[model samples]
Target: MIKHSIRVTPNRKGIWFIVNRGRIWLSAKRELPQGTYNELILSAEPEQFCLIGQLGDQDAYLLVNHDHIANEDEWVTPRELLTVSEETFQLAARAVQVALFLQTHRFCGQCGSAMSLVSWELAALCNKCGHRCYPRIAPCVLVGIVKDNQILLARSNRHRAGFFSILAGFVESGETLEQAAVREVKEEVGIDIANLRYVGSQPWPFPHSLMTGFIADYVAGDIVCQPHEIEEAYWFSFDQLPETPLEQTLSGQIIAQLKQISGNKKAT
Candidate 1:
């Protein structure tokens, strides 16, 4: 479905680039412009570059340590990229992930040997010790617990004031996604949950994380916020909920879903 190639063609308009230090260099309009790699006037050729993938009819490339090319172009961070079109955002996210992978995989961890990119795949190969490494995608679980017309939300100590979100944690080794969901919920809020139904998944590219979402019904236990983790935890009625995450995130999506389900139930 998705086409990817290593070939670079000259005379094309300009290439979309994920440039230095995990930022995207694009037109000043904050959009993907029509262009080719040949049109870019760089101070020097990029030391590291990879053809990430074809976005629509254009090829996007990820370049490391790129020199500033034009005054009309602006560099945007990954978070700012999310405000653009969904297609552009997804492309930029993928480019960032690839760039980060290349940056950290230059040397083999096991043999201390220099590693080279494998031509046919997205991986690093250590010729000396025959070690190969691929981009890491950490799996995380996000769970929304619903009880009647009220939903459980928590404020993490790390978040800014007034921001609340559902329970979430990274999946540890040798644990199932369901197990992680339950454990995270209990450990973070001191509550028990059951009927963890798979809701959805999102590719969160803050250095490559795959968030798997789940919705669970509250079974038992009173709220006991974990120190240094959850600053506050409470069950808020649907109409009286506090400030939550943006709808673009999995946590916000799950919360919206819960609201819709509750509304329908009340209507019927």
Candidate 2:
């Protein structure tokens, strides 16, 4: 059962780091400690990653990168990000996720008091008041709306100019994740869906969000993209599916399953 799923790597201690200008670097091999990374102390543990900011950035927490790095630039030299594995992104994302929460919760929502990290737990303690704060991740439902023989997808203004993604929205109060899934499809693409099926989920910590994926049958209505949210939307035939964007994620997984199921039905 677990053989096909993504596995996360554990963070170990005693790893030497290279702090070039500002960013930190992790070596490729466990024993190879090359470059200026050896000079800096292990400020946080292996799982903890740093949130870079200006002076007096009290809200910043740490994030750890164990995966092989993917992107490395001179100015934002992400040594760890460059050398980590694909599976490690989940761990790194989790670290940054906590930091992202801390960053946003540094100030008290109740009394505007500055919050400090709690040593015992993953929370912050307010200085002026007794309020304890923690990070938050807004829940969102991303769905693939399918009809007779096609799936509905749209180009988002939220992403890069030409990138298209599944219809999605933040889960509103009093609504279950499933309800949100149906509502989001209606609000974004002006379509109703049935046979709501859970696909999978991803930890999208670009600030913080738990993206729940679903595959729903398009019941009716024309593809009317909501303004400010969706720019263009259309149903593409399964055999003639549009060029899917890069990155294998929850959305990608949903598409893969859809293709498999659709194909099996045709054969039978």
Q: Which candidate is the best by TM-score?
A: 1
lDDT leader = 1
List CA RMSD, all candidates.
2.6, 9.1
| TM-score, predicted candidate 1 vs. hidden true structure | 0.90
Q: Taking the tens digit of each residue's C-alpha lDDT, what string does model 1 give over 1-268?
A: 2223355456644356646667777665666556666766556767676766666766666666556656524777666666555566666777777778888999999999999988878889999999999889999999999998889999999988888899999999999999999999989988899999999997777669888999999999999998888999889898888899877777889999999999999999
Model 2 bad stretches (over 4 Å): 1-86, 160-162
Report the C-alpha lDDT of model 2 over 1-268, residue by residue, as the tens digit.
Answer: 0011112234322222333223434444432232233343344434333332211212222334344243344212222342354444444445455545544676888899887666545677887878987667788888887776677778878666555667888999898999999888888888888899888887765447888889988788887889987888888777977666444566767777777788888899
lDDT of 2 at 39: 40
Q: Which residue pairs show collisions in model 1?
A: 13-35, 13-36, 14-35, 14-36, 15-36
Instruction: Report the lDDT of model 2 for residue 58.
Output: 24
Q: Number of clashes in model 2?
A: 19
- Which sections of candidate 1 miss by over 4 Å? 1-9, 12-15, 66-73
Q: State each model's CA lDDT, in order.
A: 0.80, 0.60
